[model samples]
Target: MSVTNSFDQLATLRAVLLATPLFAVGLTLAAYLLGICVFQRLGRPTWLPAILVAALMLAAVLSLTGIPYQEYQQGAAWLTVLLGPATVALGMPLYQQLPRIRELWRPLLFSLPLAAGLAVIYALGIAWLLGASPTILASLAAKSVTAPIAIGITQQLGGSVALLMGALLITGVAAIAFVSLLARWMGIRDERIIGFALGLNGHALGTVRAFEIGPTAGAFASLGMSLTGVLTALLLPLAWRLLTLAGMSVGS
Candidate 1:
């Protein structure tokens, strides 16, 4: 009788896990924690960031289980919703870095538009060169912007949100790797410059990395990310429209 009861309890637990969103949430947290453990154990290597590890683990589990991404996203969307509040929280650090920002405002003002413009241009240019369809180019155009803004831009340009999300992940990881290597090679030691570049190029992932470096770096990263998102959202669509009017075909 006791053995039967034990089996029944296990069955009940399995049913609950399958029926509720808790399973997805729990899996995500577990994978992230495991990634953190591995990252620490691996001496915190830059190439093996915790987020990347978590993503790989998640992908493996989904693939092995044959679970559709849409189902998993149903639960994971809760976490995505929190990104806005988390971004707003960065204002505290930005406040702390106000003096530094004021001192460097001139250079930052000049660099922000230039960086934002190049980010869109280069991504579109590369995609066009590869003969990507217009939809693909649109999706790639806002790769450097933050998620919420990127989503809007993608929608405006009639791009695939799914593709944009994938692009954002790839861009973030690549930005972190390249920025680290280039910073070391160029002897750029200022965390401010590094953090700004990371945020401008990588968005949330870069901001996370900047925070890991220090509060000042995190603050600058938040500023860069916010500005880049705003600039890209405001201008990319207009630029794309102008190009289209001029008969600049993006290969479908």
Candidate 2:
């Protein structure tokens, strides 16, 4: 090839490499849109989550093609990077719900700490029973919160990021699919309870469903989810360490 043509070809290849992440993002977006359309056509309930379907499809394709997760993540990480700003964007909804929050300040204040404590207890119990490493257990604990916060907490607590991502996805999907059933079984349909379940248990997907339910529910759910993250980050590890020390003391 001529020197000019060679340089042009390399430049084109570089552009393609740079565009690869967009392709991953596009695949996820297309899957989401397709899922919505398919679910709507089937007349499925709003609770039928589309993200799980998209994630499964993408995972299958990646597995079948033998594309290294490292390469895929290189492009996929861009989408991950945007997750921070997207989470912060929820402030818009929370802002509108501020007056209601003030009216229910006592309940809101009470629920945050309670939810966080419950989360830590549940995670540690499960981890101990499953024989998970400290890091894996920590990652699992982080799973109930938003991705950016979960990831940061996971790293700080010595958890596997990949495992944490998987756990988070599973937790969110389960909460979306089953929380309503759990609520109805308990004879509860209060928006606050529903919203708290979503935020505390469901993360983003549950919060999305909460928004559909009503503003009050959505507001509380967002608060629950956000504060749970804060609580998990601050206290889960310390509690874990204390519990471990207590056990060691007893054993000795």
Candidate 3:
């Protein structure tokens, strides 16, 4: 009788787990629609992105309901996996912008290191100051790249992939919401500067916002996103390992 009861419970649990994806998607779409309504009501400022609000609302709902992040992630993994193909698709537009890229190599080359350095430095410094785990710090160091690349680097560096994902999402949203305002404040209104700042700090969402701004901004944003990914992937692990070797203990 106990064995039969256990089997029934297991079957029920399996059924619930199988239904999780549908639940997640339904909730996500509802949240996005609600966010759009809210944004429209709020006058649709560039500093108040709909996607950010939607994601935050969903996150709050899931947290309040005690949903295991694993369950939500299982449902969301489809979009995560599609990111690779989507990134590749960006290359089509990038190809059209090749001449512009070539013309700006001097500034682009200089900006790559400067932008990447600031990202890592700011993140690592803050994490360390907070006495965060080495793994958390390492994950922070990868937060600016696309999801797949960020996840890969985080895993290799012994960081939490979920933490890295959360950081990336937060950074992307916040950057989109604030970078334009920041650019205006600093008088950094050049299209390339605007795009590069957005991409280096915000990644894909920033690129999306840049496209909304204008073609020139989008081109630079795309380039910044691509280069940030390549540089962060190639350099961050070595930098972490070097830190460990240098008695800094970045991610042990």
Taking all chains together, each candidate's TM-score versus the true structure is 0.88, 0.83, 0.86
- The sequence of per-residue lDDT tens digits that candidate 1 reaches over residues 1-252 is 999999788778755665678888899999999999999999988767898899899999989866778778776877777777887888899999999989899999999999989988888888899999988998999999989889889999899988998899888888888989999999998989999999999999999999999888889999999999989888889988898777756545
- Candidate topping TM-score: 1
Give every collision pair in model 1: none
Q: Which of candidates 2 and 3 reaches a greater TM-score?
A: 3
- Candidate 1's C-alpha runs over 4 A off are 1-19, 248-252
What ranking emerges by TM-score with the best candidate at the front?
1, 3, 2
Measured on C-alpha atoms, candidate 2 has an lDDT of: 0.78
> Which of the predicted structures, 1 or 3, would earn the higher TM-score when compared with the native?
1
Pairs of residues at least 3 apart in sequence or in different chains that clash in candidate 2 = none
Residue-level lDDT of model 3, residues 1-252, one tens digit each, is 999999788778756865767767777789999988988899877767777779889989878866778888788778778888887777776788788878889988987988888888998998899899887887788888978788889999999988887898789888887887888888887888898788878998888888888888887888889889999999999988888888755444
lDDT of 2 by residue, 1-252 (tens): 699998788767755754668766676688778777766776756455677666777788778755666667777787888988978887777788888777877877787787667756686687879898766777787778889888988787778888888887888878876888888888987887788788888888788878878987888778878878777778876876787799799999
Better of 1 and 2 by TM-score: 1
